[model samples]
Target: MFRLLIDADSFPLGKGPMVMLILFLISTIFIFARSEEQGQKLEFWIFANTHFEEYQTRVPIFEAENPGVNVQLINFGGTMHDKLLAAMLSNFGAPDLVEVEITSIGRFLKGAIDEVGFVDLRPRLESEGWMEKLVVSRFTPWSYRGRIYGIPHDLHPVVLLYRDDLFKAAGVEMTEVETWDDFIAAGKKATRDLDGDGTVDQHAIVLDRRTESDYFSLLLQQGGGFFDEEGNVIIDSELAIETLEFFVSLFNEHKIATPVYGTWHGDPSNFAAMQDGKILSILAPDWYVGILKSQVPQMAGKWKAISMPAWKPGDRRTTTRGGTMIGITTQCKNPDRAWELLKFTYFDRGGLVNRYETTRIIPPLKSAWDAPIFKEPDLYLGGQPLGELFIELAPDLPPRYQNPYWSEGADLLNDAIFAAVTEKQTSREALTELAAKVRALIAKDQGRWRDL
Candidate 1:
């Protein structure tokens, strides 16, 4: 049998070695004890590197202000939602907080409102008066059945990004363009055979034929969407048919728009087309500003933003596109602490301003709009106050409802649009078939989730 002595003078081993071992054990224990006492380990899962970086800068401030709190920021990239959805269903391995993109939010909103995996934020928003402080319509994508489950991260107000140089050279007056009709008239003049190659070399606008989001934006701009505020399918409504017809006409009849070699946002060819003066204008959301600056820096001072051409003389001039929301999960053990972190990251003015400065994304917090950064002129847009221009359209930004079937609905709508544009089916026929498919999906989803 071996015996250990705590008395240094009577120790069997050397006093120095015993003392060192004791110190190491004590330090190890102390470290673990301190970690336990640190309180509330909040795991925040984000998919975007930019968002992860932005929150990393703010986490230390939050930890310092609220002592003994720790935040673990994880960037899971594109597979985040799938992993999150799996965790939610299994009731295991879920993060304390998560950032859900607009397209992915609907998947988290299945079943009854109470059955949602994310905590319902409506009561807090109302009690704290945050509902009024933020852009009201910005909340629509994060809410279900009047219950908001997340805080909006951006306004995403859509605007027309036009080549001012091209418009001026083509003798088009932008101010006189109030409607889509006016826009098409201007496109006729702007679309020209600059190289005299017999075929028109320059198109007035860029609309991605492969992506449904472009058509969705036009639908939203005209006060139409896949689902109405009441959660009913409206993809085949008269307004939607009209919007789809106009979308098809842009490429088929007018021939003023062309699809880029790849996606409007990612492809190098799109930037080359812009540089070569082949594409004149694009419908850009606030976040697209960062993309343009990073991709086509040479187009500085040549581009200018304007309100989107309305469908009619007095219709809404802007629509919304991409958005993100941050929410606390129902699985969080320390929900109050999680909410504090969420509020600090999203509701606090300094955090919002820092996000805008870093990402060039317009915050939904209306109070933060008055920040000097928002008022500054963007050199890339010919010294135009780009932030102010987006803000101007923010109020009129239309609401985009959340439906559990939005993902499937969007794919079906894409197919419908493709059929119409390819002349295989009329716009009405395409949309009516799309509407039937969506209704069937809704019925199937309802049957699966009886509480919905």
Candidate 2:
């Protein structure tokens, strides 16, 4: 046992203490700086649409496949614009990749996108010659601004979804109603009350006119356009009038649709009402199939789907309805890797297969058409190969509206269309009013919306 030397106020040892303190501080800062620079999130930031939860389950699959790669999702509401804007401005809020709806791609491409944060996928496409893999027709929306900005997954056609049981109970079959005229007649039959009760518990059709994006499909199918080549509102033309009239006929003339179907005329919610069995049929994209299966599993095997009716005795089959695109946001730190995931999720065969297997949502890509998932006749969809129908229908689709103000004008137009369908406003009054308001909005935007 040696005697300990006590230093109460030791002047000599104090220098040692100072040196240790400085060294400790330096070490602490070095460690912290290094940890931050490494940027460990144990995840890759990705944005997605409503089906994210189902996709998230595959994270383990992604990690297993990519080794160290891990992905995490930041779900913004169904509203991509609002969420994306919040993220872009924060710069810190930006996700590595953004999943944008195809219908809104033009808008995002034109306005919502952060000018700095995008990786032009053209180089990748050309270098890899992935363009050969793509059916050029399927890449329509991604072609805006003369450059490829996003990778497309599937041609999500807006098809008709109907309750087979309801259609059968009404003594009608989808095959018999190939044209719009026949559809109305069948709808009238399906509109009846099963119990012979006074009140009609089920509506024949649910037309959510409030969904402006959806309505655009019919408009474009009918040769109606929201804007011209230079970008100006074109909803006031005779075609626009005819489109509105057709939209309203479900309520005004056919008597097949009830208040539930026509009430939201402009603001459609076929997914909600149709899935809930409040209505017999709805018009939606293949993306809706997954929703139908997931939300109303009980209705599986009972629901059926068909392509949109021919516009002019086969003037091309149908127009593009709605879909999502995977683009690298400007805020992304790992665009190359993020784009790889993007290509996999939408354009890659494996990604398409996974989406179909887990969610049954058809991709817009061409090759996936032959994938076993698409070929499988869905028991829920009455053994129908819904995937084939979408594939055959995709090439004929016109460009889905992709302009920034298109959605804005559409929302206003739908409000009016909905009102007219429900008899809140006459058809003429509604369309005219909508056109005027949209024009005003365009004028206010002072960009592509100026008068023709």
**Candidate with the greatest TM-score versus the true structure:** 1
What TM-score does candidate 2 reach? 0.78
Model 2 clash tally, residue pairs: 21
Cα error, candidate 1, residue 78 (Å): 1.2
lDDT of 2: 0.67
- Over 1-452, each residue of candidate 2 has an lDDT whose tens digit, in order, gives 87325443564567678667668999999987864642323323334544576457655676677765667666765665666766765766666777666655555555433353456778888898788776565555665555567777566667887788878877998776667888887888778765677866678776655656545667877756777545666777778777777877876787776554444422245445665566887776776676667766777787887777765565655666666566777666666667666665566577667777775666656666787776778887878988777777766666643455666776777687778777898767877788788777667666663432
Instruction: Report the lDDT tens digits of candidate 1 across residue range 43-107.
Output: 99999989999988899999999877889999999999999999999998899999999999987
Report how far residue 238 has shifted in candidate 2, in Å.
Answer: 2.1
- Candidate lDDT scores, in order, read 0.88, 0.67
